[model samples]
Target chain A: MLKDFFRTFSSMIELEFRRLKHDRTEIYSRAVQPILWLAVYGPIMGSIRAIPTGNIPYTDFITPGVLIQSTTFISIFYGLTIVWERESGILKKLLVTPAPRYATVIGRAMASGIRAIFQTFIIILVALIIGVKFILNPFYFVLALVIIFFSSGGFAAISILVASFMKTRERFMGIGQALTMPLFFASNALYPVTMMPKALQYFATINPMSYVVDAVRSLIISGDLTNLWLDIVAIAIFNIIMFTLASVNFKKIIE
Target chain B: MEKAVDVRDVVKIFNKNFRALDGVSLEIESGSIFALLGPNGAGKTTLMRILTTQIGPSSGHAYVFGLDTVKEGSQVRKLISYVPQEMSVWTDISGYENLLIYSKIYGIPKEERNNIINGVLESMGLHDVSNRLVKTYSGGMIRRLEIACALLVRPKILFLDEPTIGLDPSARKVVWEKLKMFKKDYGTTIFFNTHYMDEAEIYSDLIAIINRGKIVTIGTSEELKHSVGGEILHFILSENGLHEDVLRELEGIEGIKDVVVSNSDVTFVVNDAEMILPHIMTFFNKKNIFVRRVSITKPTLDDVFLKYAGTRIDVSGRLSEVTHVRRMIRRG
Candidate 1:
């Protein structure tokens, strides 16, 4: 059974990888969008003195947030393909196959997680070019990538869970857009949670994206291990819940 | 002989308001090609999904090879493969890649996977285009590729829902030939849904006709055709049309089971065509209703359907004549 799970999971990931590889426009856009934000939006936002970053520059402060933003955008949109698959009847074909439901969803999450890492890499490279410095620890960098994968996976699960109910492209786009902005803004991705109003601050604190950004920031800028484990534990629990829900819902929607 | 599929009193309802499958039941003999004939929305696809283990029936049971489809879906899947109504292949990927993915999913050992993919592709006559993206292939090639993928696992039973729905006649023939070869070579039980009655009549060993989510009839071509136990008579009028008295006069003739009059033709179902032809000709002679042409044929599956369902299976508009009088049959 374990062999079956891993075989199905790897094949699904491979399918997604091949699909993205052939899609030049998607790869180009995925690579270009984050760099644009890093080079364009980061400079403009960094100049504001009102922004709170204890010692790190605002550009560096927003770097982790931008990485999380890129991950959120990519992960949320990953589900649009599921809607397309449903329309094209691929989902029906796959559902009839022997592949496990959770494996299929996990493979998809891993694929988009891998894509999120590439997009994050582009943002980080642009950050270096734009004069943002990191602690340059290999361990922290690997830890940051792990955080990105799970956080992106958590968001991808939410996207897939909602997507399973969407039978049409227009409905998927509407829900995706509705969820994307709120998830990004409610978290500390673009701003400090301390600077937000009380209600928004409350949402930011519980938001999984907040933990991901905090974890990344701690590893890269401050080189602080404090709160690192907390963020990891929180994101891990969030992923498990979201993934279990998504997998269960995936089978239900088809029925 | 083992039964490849057994569906007993299966009922499927959607949203508590719609009953998609209403007490549908059927049994398909192992290693025989079975075709399901139904009009649109007749629950053919629903029943196929149930047997394929993609969905559960609202009530009752469905089994494939003695295993309950709902309870032993994984075991059932190992013994069967499905080709859905739609084109399920990834258009952007090469045909080889598509087969490779399925081979892995089917858990073919790593060493034999490539050989099985190659063998299946070659058998489907898709080897030449194996490296080409599916989008570049013609509709027929894509359909063949779907079959090739299904065959990689060497499933004992292959379920195809409208396997050749939108293809050209030649393409449809190619798909059928491949399916026939697959059946012959491996003795695979092939169950399929088709809009083409002629295809169903010719290719299937046993055919089951479903109407309004119930099995109207199940038999071989000859048995289904002979179900009505009569012959059909079609009379083409000489433009002057039928006399008002003709139907009344024909009803008086012995062995005439029923009569249906249309704009330019009159069709009759009778116990024996030879016995009734002379009486019908004499009646037309007396009424001055010109019979331009007369053709007598053994009962068709269409007649079997009209006998049971009270309407012709109207895939082709040839059943337009039946439509005009179908309500009369229903009312009676």
Candidate 2:
């Protein structure tokens, strides 16, 4: 049984790699959009006011948030692949193939996670070029990457669950884009939670993306993630809940 | 021999009002080509979908390899391959990659997958286009590739729904040839659904005629043609018209089973055309009506559909006529 699981996982990775190699334009757009956020949106918040978590340059402040932000935005594109699969009838083809049916969704989510990491690394490299001090610990960076991976994966799962319920690509795009902005804005991606009213602060505090961004921000900027153990446990619980909800909802919607 | 697939009085209603399949039932032998023939909306695709565990029957049950379709879908799904009517391949992947993904899913060992993919592609005559993205490939190529995917898993029972619906004649012939070869090689039981009567007549060991959510008849093509028992006489009369009573009398004359009137053209299914044609022509002559034209032919599967399903190919506009297909073939 364990052997079967690994076989499915490896093939799924191969499928995702093929997809990445298959679409060069997707690669360009993925790189270019986060850079656009880096070039423009990352600085506008800088000149306005001292960022909530202290006098940290707004770039460094929103840097982790922007990575999570763009990653979350990119999460919905996973549904575009699914929508195309549905239109091309590939979903039906995958449906009847005997083993590892859920692997299709898992493969896609993990592929998009890798995509998120690539996009984040690109943005971080840009920041590094501008002389953001380098942190020397590989373990914390790896932990931070895991936090983003699970966060983006939870978001991708929800994206797929939504895609299963939608019939057409156009409809999914419109609805996916519409939902993305509100969810991103509600979090601390653009501004810290203390900048918000009491009610919105509660929501931002509970936003899993907020936990993810704050955790990563501690690693890159402060070098000590505030209450590092609590951050780890909280985000783990969030990932469990969201992934579970997405999988349960995934079966119901597709059926 | 045990039944490979058995659908028992199955009924599928989509939204309480839209009835897709109504009380349909049949038994498929372990290793034979069973063709379901009908026009669009005739419930052929719906029945296939239900049999393949894609949907549930509203009022009955289906069994595959002695496992209930709804109750034990995974066991059944493990053994059969379903190639749906739509083109279901990734537009961006090569035909070879498509097979690779499915073979992996079927848990073929890494060492064996390449050989299996290559062998299937070579047999389907797709080796040359194996690396081409499916979206850029011609319709026929994509279809053959889908057939290759179904075969990749080496399914014991294969269900192909309108497998060659949009292919050119030459391409369609190639697919049918491959299917015949596959059946011979593996003794795979094929449930082939199609709207093309000629394909059904040529390839199916047994044919089931479905219409308006019901199976109207089922038999070997020869048996169906034999059961209809006669020739068809077609007459086109324009300037003169016969009284309804007179036409009725001619229709009742012993040799005929049914009379079909379309505009001034009257078609009749009669047992003995040598006797009926002369009588029909003489009746028109006695009425001083000019005979525009007349033709007669032996029983065809089309005639069997007309006789048993209460439909005439030309007059029943509810379904596309054979003439439409003939025109398409001519146009192509």
Candidate 3:
């Protein structure tokens, strides 16, 4: 059973990779937004010191946040593909296969994570060019990669869960837009969580994206392993819950 | 011989109120091509889904090779493949890539995968275009690619829902030809659902006529046509108009089984068109109703559906005569 699950997972990832190869322009297009944030928004906000970042420069502090933001955007909109697949009959074809339902769900969620990872590479390259300093530790970088993958995966699974109930792409898009901005703003992606109101602080603490940004920031910028366990545990728990719900509800799209 | 599929009194109700399949029961013999012929909303897809284990029947049972579809769904999935009614291939990917994904999904070993994919592509006549993106291919090629994906595992039983819908006549023929070859080569039990009377009559070894969630009749094409048991005498009357009363009068004549009138066209299902044609001509002559053209045809599956289901199977307005005949049959 485990063998079958991994095979299915790898096959699905390979399928997405083939599709991505055919459309390499998407990678280039997706990099535009994060570059804009780093080059334009980061400079303007950093010069003004609009948000406190202790000793770190504002541009460097927001670099990881920008990466998480772009990753969240890519991951959350992944459900649109599911809706399209349902419309085009591809989902039906996949569901009829002998693969277990959970395998299919996780396979697709991981595929989205890989796509987000591609975007992560672009953002980090832009961050380096813009003079954002990192601690230069290979171990911290690897941990940050793992955190980005699983956090993007959890967000993608949430998107799939929404797709299982939202049959139409238009409705899914509406919900996706409503979701992405709020999740970005409620988290500490842009401003410090301490600066937020009490109600918003509660949201920031529970928001999975905040943990993702915090983990990534600590690993890459401060090289601090403090709270790294909390960050990893929180993201892991979030992924487990989201993946379970998404897999259980995956068949509902066809119904 | 063992049955390939056995569906016993299967019932599928949707949304608590709509009964899609009231009580569908039938058995398909192993290694034979079986077809479920029905009009739209006739529950053909519903029944196929149950057998494919995509959905369980609300009540009763369905089995593929004696394995309960609901309980043994995983096992049944291992032995069968399905081509759904809609276009199911991934258009953004090349045909080879699409087949490769299915081959992996079916768990064909890595070493044998290329050979099997190549074999199916060649058989489906898609080898030349296998490297091309599917969106660039014609509708027929896309469908053939979908079938090629299904054939990757060489499944024992293959189910297709509306396998050739919305294709040109030539495209439809090409699809059926490939399907026939698959059945002959592998002895796969091919079960498909279609509303095309000609397809069901020509290709299927056994045809089941389903309407409104019920199997109206099941038999070989010849048997179903024989059960209708009459020739159709069709005539288009000349400019002289005939009243409804005169048309009804023809039904009273001996040897005339049924009379249907649509505009100036008159059709009579008769015991003997040779004997009844003379009477029809004499009656038309006496009334000064000149006949423009006349032809006698063997009762087709359309007539069989009209006889048994009390409705015409094709409602696309191509066969208006059959619809009129059905209305007359319903009235009597």
Candidate 4:
């Protein structure tokens, strides 16, 4: 049974890679957003100095946030592909297979996460070129990659969960648009959590994106492993919840 | 021996009010091609879905090879494959890649995957275009590829829902030919639903006509046409004459089973067309009704459908509405 699960999971990831290889344009296109943020938004915000980023340049502080933002955008809209697959009848084909339901959910969620990792590498390269300094520890760098992957996986699962109920692409898009900005802004992506009002800070503390930004930021930028365990635990719990919900609701779309 | 499919008292109600399949029950024999003939919104797709284990029947049981579809869905899935009504192939990938994905999902042995894919591709007449992206293929090639994907594991039962809806006549023929080959080679039981009367008549071993979520009639093509039990006589009246009055008058004639009129054309079913022809001609001659043309033919599946469902199966205008509902279901 376990072997079947792994085979299905790996097959789904391989299918995504094949599709990615055929159309590398999405990877390049996704990079444009992060580039604009780092080069344009980053500098303008860094000069303001009103956000109290502390010691590190504002651009450097927001680098991790921007990376997670790019992934968040991709992960949240990943359900659009699910909707398209449903419309095109591919989802029905896959569902009729002997593979377990969770295998499909986790497999597709991981595929989206893997796709986000590609954008991670692109953003890292752009960050280096723009003179954003890192601690350069290989261990923490790899750890950050793992965090980003599962974090994005969690967000993708949330998207799939929404897709189960939303059925139509237009309604899914409308809800996705309503969701992304709030999730991005409510987190401490652009500004410090301490700078927000107490209620907003509570929301930021609860936001999974905040944990991703915090863990990735500290690991890559400051090389601090102080809150690393806490962040990891938070993201892991978040993933467990999202994945379970998404898997449970996955079959509802067919109904 | 277990039947290929056995559905018993299956009911599927959508959104509390729309009873898509109302107490549908049937059994398909092993290695036989079964056609479910129905008009749009007649529960053909819904019944297929239930039998394939894509969705559970609301109030009853469906079994594939004696495995309960609901309780043993995965095992049933292993034994059967389904080609849905909508286009299921991934357009961005090459045809070979699409098959490769299914090959892996089906857990075909690594060493034999390529050989099997190549063989199926060749059999489906897709080998030459296997390396080409599916988006570049014509509608027929793409459909053939979809069927190839379903055949990878040599499933014991193959279910297709409207396998040739929008295809041209030649394309439809090609699909049926490939299906026939698969049935012969593998002894696979083929089950499909279609509105095309001739397709059901020619390819199916047995057919069941469904209307408004009920099976109106079920039998062999010959049996169904035989059940309608008469010869059809059609007369095209001259454009200057009135057809409705003639249609009414013809209905009053003794021994005419049914009379249907469209514009200046009148068609009636009679037990003996030869015996009725003289009397009808003499009546028309006395009334000065000009008969432009006349033809006598045996009853067709269309006539059978008309007899059971109270409507022709192939009303051209309803074709678009069928496609529209299918699209709406896809969107949902």
| Every candidate's CA RMSD | 7.8, 7.4, 8.1, 6.5
For model 4, residues B1-332, the per-residue Cα lDDT tens digits are 77998989989999989999999899889999999998888999999888888898889899999999999999999999989888887777799999998889889999999999998899899999999988788767878999999999999999998898877789999999998998999999999999888899999999999999999899999778768888889999886445667667877889788987777887889887888999889888988888999999988888899999999766577666656744554333
lDDT of each: 0.83, 0.77, 0.88, 0.88
In terms of lDDT, model 2 sits at: 0.77
Interface Cα RMSD, each model: 8.3, 5.1, 8.3, 2.7
Which has the greatest TM-score? 4
Worst 10 residues of 1 chain B by lDDT: B323-332
The DockQ figures for the candidates are: 0.40, 0.36, 0.36, 0.43
Candidate 1 lDDT over B191-307, as tens digits, reads 998756888899999999888889888999777876788789999988745566656867878888888888888899987788889988888888777788999989777777788
Candidate 1 local lDDT, residue A5: 87
TM-score versus the correct structure, for each prediction = 0.86, 0.83, 0.87, 0.88
| Native-to-model Cα distance after best TM-score fit, residue A235 in candidate 1, in Å | 1.1
How close to the true structure is residue B46 of candidate 2, measured as C-alpha lDDT? 88
Arranged by lDDT, best first: 4, 3, 1, 2
Steric clashes per prediction: 0, 0, 0, 0
The chain B TM-scores of all candidates, as shown, are: 0.77, 0.76, 0.78, 0.79
- Clashing residue pairs in candidate 1 (N, C-alpha, C atoms within 3 angstroms): none
Worst lDDT run of 10 residues, candidate 2 chain A, spans A246-255
